[model samples]
Target: MASRSRLHVAVFLAPAVLVYTAVMIWPLFNTLRLSLYVEADGVRSFAGLANFATLFGDPRWSEAFWNALGNNFWFFVVHMLVQNPIGVALAAILSHPRLRFAALYRSAIFIPTILSFVIVGFAWKLILSPIWGIAPGILDAVGLKALFAPWLGREEYALTTLALISVWQFVGIPMMLIYAALLSIPEEILEAGEIDGITGWSAFWRIKLPLILPSIGIISILTFVGNFNAFDLIYAAQGALAGPDFSTDILGTFLYRTFFGFQLQLGDPHMGSAIATAMFAIILAGVCIYLFAIQTRMRRYQF
Candidate 1:
């Protein structure tokens, strides 16, 4: 009977397993295989970990790798600092019982989340452009025109500014996720808190906040993975060079440049594969840390 039940479960799971193997497992294996071989002068040869060695050992490759990694971290930090807080604030406001037009506000806030990265990037680029942009006009209307400059065109502010723009586009995601989580908390629990002399700010900080921590953890992990995987926005706004002197280059764009030739530098498939593998490893390590280390502790609380 046990063997029959096992067979039944396997039969039920077969289609999903097949699809997973075909779409995800197969491509991952292929990339890993390609990473093991080197191609040059129209010739391919097995290179073991030489590609990875060059990725880390060679200054030319290593410099860009480290720079991109650092930039990616900064991008992630910006989202954590600006985006999540803004999302939480908005979610708190929208969750208020007396708030009118809440549905409309939620929909409007979420609109940008559905937009393609290309559209968001170019729209922001045009909005921030100095020559024929509305940003300067708005600042001028506010009597702050002097502060307006081409932020996207400047090296010192480019990456940070772009990160803010991305935050603007995606903040809605966290807001919605957190809002739902907040709503899921029992109203009785909140009322109990109020009866126990906990209400308003105190209720939120001491009660609601702890309850929503698991959602925040999920958002943080998602942000980490999404930020590391991001490519389209930077590509659309700054091109593959991620210029303004490569100020916005992240692992995604760096891998793109390595995989495909740009200007004078020829593409190196092996190097690209190495970069991709490194990114995979980084993402895996982060997820593992979050799951094994942080998640266990976070889940121990009944809330």
Candidate 2:
């Protein structure tokens, strides 16, 4: 009977396994294999870890690699610091039973999340453009015209500007996730908290916040993965060069530039694969840490 049950499970799992292997597993294996080979003098050969060495040791490659990594970290940080907090706040507000027009507000916030990357990037580029953009006019109306600068064109401001744009585009994801989590909290638990004099902000802080920790953790990890994988918007706005002077280059763009030819260098699939492997390692490590260390502690707070 046990053998029959196991066979039943295998039969059900086989199709998904085959599809996963074809799409995800096979591509990952090929990338790893490609990462271990190098081309030299019109010949390609197994290079073991030499590609990784070059990625770190050679300044030409290492400098750009480090820069992209740092920029990527900043991008992630911006989302965590600005995006998630606002999402939680918005979710808290919208979850209120008496809040007026909540569905309309939710739909409006969420619409941007579904927009095409190119459209968002292109529209923002036009909005921020100095010559014809409305930003300066709006600032002028608000008596802060001097505050308006070429945000996307400046090295110091470009990444942050793009990060904020990204935040605007996707903040609704965490909001919706948190909203669902908030809604899932049993009324009895909330009533008990109320019986203890917990109400308003007190109720949210003592009751709702703790219950939603797991959802927030999931959202955080999702944000980490999504931000690390981000390339489309940056590419759409900045192109492959990621200019002004590669200020906004993240790992995805870096990998793209290395994997495909840019103005400066011919495509090097091996190095590109190495960069991809590194990105995988970083994301894997981060997820593992969250699952093992942080999540274990968070579970103690789970009711």
Name the candidate that leads on lDDT. Answer: 2
- Please write out the lDDT profile of model 2 over residues 1-303, one tens digit for every residue: 555556777999999999999999999989989999999998999999999999999999999999999999999999999999999999999999999999999999999999999999999999999999999999999999999999999999999999999999999999999999999888988898889899999899988998898999999999999999999999999999999999999999999999997997899999999999999999999999999999988853435
- Residue-pair clashes per candidate: 0, 0
lDDT of model number 1? 0.92
* Backbone-clash count (model 1): 0
**Model 1 spans with C-alpha error above 4 angstroms:** 299-303
Please state every model's RMSD to the true fold in angstroms: 1.3, 1.3
Task: Tell me the TM-score of model 2.
Answer: 0.97
Where does candidate 2 stray beyond 4 Å? Answer: 3-5, 300-303
- lDDT agreement with native, every candidate: 0.92, 0.95
